[model samples]
Each structure stands twice: as structure tokens, then as C-alpha cells.
Target: MGWLKDDVALITGGGAGLGLALVHRFIDEGASVVVLERDANRADSLKRKFGEKIETVVGDVTSYEDNVKAVETAVERFGRLDTFVANAGVFDFFKPLSEFEGPEISAAFDELLSINVKGGLLGARAALDALIKSKGSMIFTVSNAGFYTGGGGPLYTASKHGLVGVVRQLAHELGPKVRVNGVAPGGMRTSLSGLKATNTADESLETMEGFEELIIGITPLRMSPTPDQYCGPYVLLASRENAAPMTGVVINTDGGLGVRGIMNVCGGEDLSA
Candidate 1:
């Protein structure tokens, strides 16, 4: 049997990118999923693809009511919620702080943090009662930017860093009942978009030239992973028996970013010798 057999999870931004990958992986592991996606078309596509296996809520994460509705749907449909994955986020395209004008920085910060940070908090709050009853967990989809530099620009970095803090603080506050943790995945090719405030809502990482090469060059693994590859960590974290004592931890699935050498990204280049 799968580790998460019979578990029910509610995930934000489940229409695309890593969120979509998580939805598929969770189902494969025997979990029923409820997705909160802002785009109607993507929501419909998920319904068509998963059919009665998953539920879709076409709503933005930044709205508390929408989050509440998603939680309610999960309980009402699946009978209970075993996990809440806060995975909705936007990128900053590495736009340096100096490149942003006074009002632009403020606008971008507000918009990005609203969805990235505030949305997580709101979703956790909405899922609090159910998680406590089920003794469930909350998994935030952090980024390489959460712990390191240059993963994103100042605004994006700040938002992710703030999320790391949320993971720790919430774990402390919700412990003895509900587990809270995070997974900081490295760069991957996805449709992860940028803030509208920065006029980059239309821009996507998938369209960026040499994006995969850039990630592989810096990562010691010497490879760029797809969204589905990152789902394993989430699966482990969400499994009650597997991750029974794993609260307050943020697993760094960033291809050994912390171990990069001063002279070379990976020191064992000639290991075959």
C-alpha cells in the first residue's frame, strides 16, 4: 500500500508548475487532492485529467475565504483533510533592487508577499481545525532562494526567506497536534510567472533561454530537474509514519547548493578516474 493511502490533501496553485506535479504524485501515492487554482481553464483541465479522483477550486490563494472554501471542500468531499500544501508563489525574474523604482518595489513586494507569505498563513489558519483533528501536516513549497543568494532578486528572495520563518514559527505554534514543515527545491523549468506589479505576469521561466543550463551549471548535481522529480520530498514529508517527527524542518532539495566549492561547483568531477 502507498504511504498516504486514504489521505486527503488540499494544495494551493495546483493547476500548474510544481503544484500540478504534486497533485499527480499525491494521487499516485493514494491521496485524494483538492486544488485551489486561480485560473479557470487550468482548474477545468485538472478536473478533466483527474476526473472524480480530485476536486478543483477556482480561487486565488490570497483570499482567506477562498482558502476556507477549499478546506471545506476537502472535508466535505473526502471526509477529512490530512495535509495542506502551501505551494502558490511568483518569481521576480532576478530584477535587481536598483532596477525597481520607488513605487514599483513597494507594489511588487506587496503583490508577491501577499500570495507567497500571507496566503500560506491564511491557508494554515483555515486548515487548522481539520489538521489538528487528523494530526496532519502543512508543507510549504519553499525555494532555493529561501536560504541562498541570487536564486532570485531582492523582492523574491525576501518573500521566500520570510516563508522559511513562517515554517519554523508555525511548527512551534502548532506542534503537539499539527506538523508544519517545508521543502526548498532548486531551480526547475516551469511556467512559474512573475508579479504583475513588475510587469512580468506574462513572462515565464519555461520561455527563458538557457534556463536549464544555468541551473545545471550552478548545481553540483550537474542536472536540471523537472517538477515531478521534486514531488518525492513532499511525499515523504506528508506521510505520517515516515515523517512522524519531522516538524519544523525545511528539507533543502536544491541539488547540494550548500556544498558548492569555492573553486568548483562540484569537486569530484574526475570521480570516474
Candidate 2:
């Protein structure tokens, strides 16, 4: 549906998982994309896959300079930037507070928060002027952990919760010119991994055994969606015509995670005709 026809977007961490999915969705919806990825190989792969329809910038989201470069690339290549999607993130692999040593906790917290939270802040700031000029939108990728417990351990949960606040405050702060919103999607098998400081950098989310079953069993919808299934909200938020009334909103794409039953996780398990 060319919801974003002629629009231009910059997506951080757009080399894999949800980020890669967003890149595909945005382009399919008729938007030109610029991806900021830290991995050189991933950048090369994106270039090969999409050709001139997309631009790949080898950069990290946590660095202000890198964020600026990506934003600049979007503006320079596409003439304007209509959307800035801050989607780069890392996980903590459900390691609870008790599992962490005091020093390790400090180090891991700093690393994870810097990527999951600070990265968004920096990207928004870097794109602030361009977004205002075009009256564009900013879509942040949060998680079910943003609103409820059990989605992740303390570190991951806290980071997502922080994005919820960022969405609200930025929407308020950038009003009348730029729109700010977010998406809180449920479990998806992604390359999302834990912090190096936590010794779980090599552990991707998809490697978590029973993860698919866990999502299917817990949500009221009784299904685990993939990254592509989660791109609609981002597209809506990015669309100037369709989402004109949206701002300071965070769509919960977690298959009714908010309505989970206390006893069974899904109350409709015994539904009868």
C-alpha cells in the first residue's frame, strides 16, 4: 500500500531482525531508506540486496557523530527525511538482578542502556532539525517489557520502559512540527543479543530454547509473530496522511499481552462454539 510514497526514512540497526524487516516494509510501502548499521558486512549485504532504493551507512547508533552521518545520508540521498526509526537494541537474556555481581551489574546496565535508550535520544537529536523541517515522524522500537514484567529481566525491562517515557516526552517536546511515537512488539526470533559486559553477547534471542512456545503460550492471541508482522504500526506512524492524529502513542503489538489471564495466560483457551 504506498502509505509512505515518496517519503524518506533512516533506520538504525536496520541490518537485521526487526530493523531489516522495517527496511523492507518501508521500501515496499514506497519510501526510500537509509540504514545505519555497525557491521560492515551487513551494510554491504543491504547495499547488494536493495541497490539504489536503499542507502547503507556503516555506523553505530550510540555515537552522536554516527547518528548525524546516517541522518545526513538520508537527507542528502533522498532530498528529505520523513521518518527516523530508532530500532537498534540489545537484550539481557533474562538474567535477574540477583544473578549479577555488583560491578557486573553496573557495567552491563551502562552498556545496555546506552544502546537501547541513549541511542534513541542521540538519533532523535541528530534528526531533530530535518524532522522539523519536513514535519516528519520518529518511531521507536520498544518491547512488551516496556509495559509489563516478565518480558525480560531487570535490565532489558528497564530499557524498554525508558523508551516509553522517551516517546511521550519527545512528542511533547517536538510538537506542531514533528511527531514522536513508538511500537511495543512482543516476542520475535531476532539477532537481538545480550550485552558483552554480561558475557551474553553471543547469545541471540532466537537461540533461547522454547522462546516460540513461550510467546505462543502466554499471549491472549496464542501466536508468536515475526518481525514482518510487527511493521504495520511503524508504517502507520510514519505515514503523514494516515497517522496525522497520532503522537505520543506507543502501539502494543504484543498479541494481547496486556490482557493475559492470571491463571492460564490465555483465558479463551477453552472457548466453545
Candidate 3:
């Protein structure tokens, strides 16, 4: 039998990248998924590919009403809600704080925190009762950035760090009946493009050639995983039988990257040396 057989999963940002990977994995493992996406086109594409096995709702994660609708739809369609994954988020453009005006900083902070922080809280709140009834779990899509500095710029890092706190707090508040956990992914490829000028994976590599050098060299595994590889951590967290004692745990599936300190070398030379 599949690990998630008969479970109903609700995933935010489910139309692409890690979210899409989770939906596919969950369905393959026998769970039915309800996807919450802001992009209608992406939702439509998911529906066309997966048919009724997956349900797609196009809405912004930052909206409480949208979160409610997603939960309602999941329970109404699947008979019960078994898992909630708060995976909706955006990247900052790597602009330094000095470059940001007060209004710009406020706007960026609000935008990032609204979707990344408040959105997760909203999803959990909306689905809390159902999860309690089903003894289900809450999972967040944090990043290695949550624990370290290099995964993103300050804004992205702060947002992820805030999410880590959310996981911990929720786990404490909803314990014994409902579990809460997070998955922190490291370097991986995904299309979080065009919204701004934050370094792309390739661009970062070129701008700081051997940018991945320090990370790979320090990691015991010496490799960066694809986005799909991160899905297993979520699946495990969502599985009651597998992760029964794992409440409040933040699984850093970052290929050991988080353990290594951030690279501060200039011109490919270790400054400390």
C-alpha cells in the first residue's frame, strides 16, 4: 500500500516547483491532493494533467478567505483533511537594505512576510480543527535559508527564519493531537523568475564562479539535489505512522549544506587564509 493511501493533502503554491513535486509524489503514494495556486493557468494545467485525482483552486495564499476556501474544498471533496502544506512563497531580488527606501522596504517586507509567514499561519488556522479531528499534520516549505545566510538575501532569509518559528510554535500549541514540522531545502533549481533581480541559480554561479564551490566542498555528499528530492521529507513528515514522534522537527534536507558556513571568499580566494 502507498504511504499516504487515503489521505487528503492540501498544498499551497502547488502549481509549480516544490509544490508541484509534492502533489505528484502524494498522488503517487495514494493520497488525494487539493492544490492552492495564485496562477489560474498553472491550476488549469494541473487539472488537465491529473484530472479529478487532484483539485485545483486559484487564489492568493496571503488571503485568509482563499485559505478558508482551500480547506473547505479539501474537506468537502475528500471527506477529511489529512495534511496541510504551506508552500507558497516568493524570492527577494537580492537588493541590499541600503538601496531600499522606507516605503520600498515596508512593501517588500509586507509582501514577503504576508505570503511566507502569515500565509502559513492562515493555512494552519483554517485547517486546525479538521487536522485535530483526523490527527493530521502541518508542514511548511522553509529553506536552508531559514537556518543560514546564503540561501537568499536578508528579506528571504528573515521570512524563512520566521517560518521556522511558526513550525515550532504550532507544534507546541497543537501537540499530541496534531503534529507540525518543516522541510528546509538547500540549493535546487526552480523557476522563481522575472518578478525581480534576485540571483538565479546559473547567474549566481557565473557572478561568483565556484559559488557552489564552498557548499559542495563542505557537504559530506558533495552534491545539490533537484527540487523533487525534497518531496520525500514532506511526505515523511505528513505520514503519521512514519513521523509519529517527530513533532516540532525541522528536517534540514539541505544535503548537509546548512552545516557548512556561508561562503565569504572574494575573487575565489579564502580571505581568512
TM per prediction: 0.97, 0.97, 0.87
Which is the better candidate, 1 or 2, if ranked by lDDT? 1
On lDDT, the candidate that comes out on top is: 1
Q: Ten-residue segment with the worst summed lDDT in candidate 2?
A: 264-273
Lowest lDDT block of 10, candidate 3: 193-202
Question: lDDT values of the candidates?
Answer: 0.93, 0.93, 0.82
lDDT of 2 by residue, 1-273 (tens): 899999999999999999999999999999999999998998899999999999989988889999999999988898999999999999999899999987999999999999999999999999999999999999999999999998899999999999999999999999989999999999999989888898899999878899998888788777889999999999999998999999999999998888776844534453422
Candidate 1 lDDT by residue in tens digits, 1-273: 488999999999999999999999999999999999999999999999999889999999999999999999999999999999999999999999899988888889999999999999999999999999999999999999999999999988998999999999999999989999999999999999998998899999999999998887777777799999999999999999999999999999988888867634544463324
Off by over 4 Å in 1: 265-273
Residue-wise C-alpha lDDT for candidate 3, range 1-273, written one tens digit per residue: 489999999999999878899989999999999999998999999999898888988998888999999999999988999999999888764556777766667767777778889999998999999999999999999988899776767788899999999999999999999999999887665555322332232232224445456555556556656668888988899988999899998999877664444542222333334
For model 1, the local distance difference test gives 0.93
**Deviation (Å) of 186 in candidate 2:** 0.3
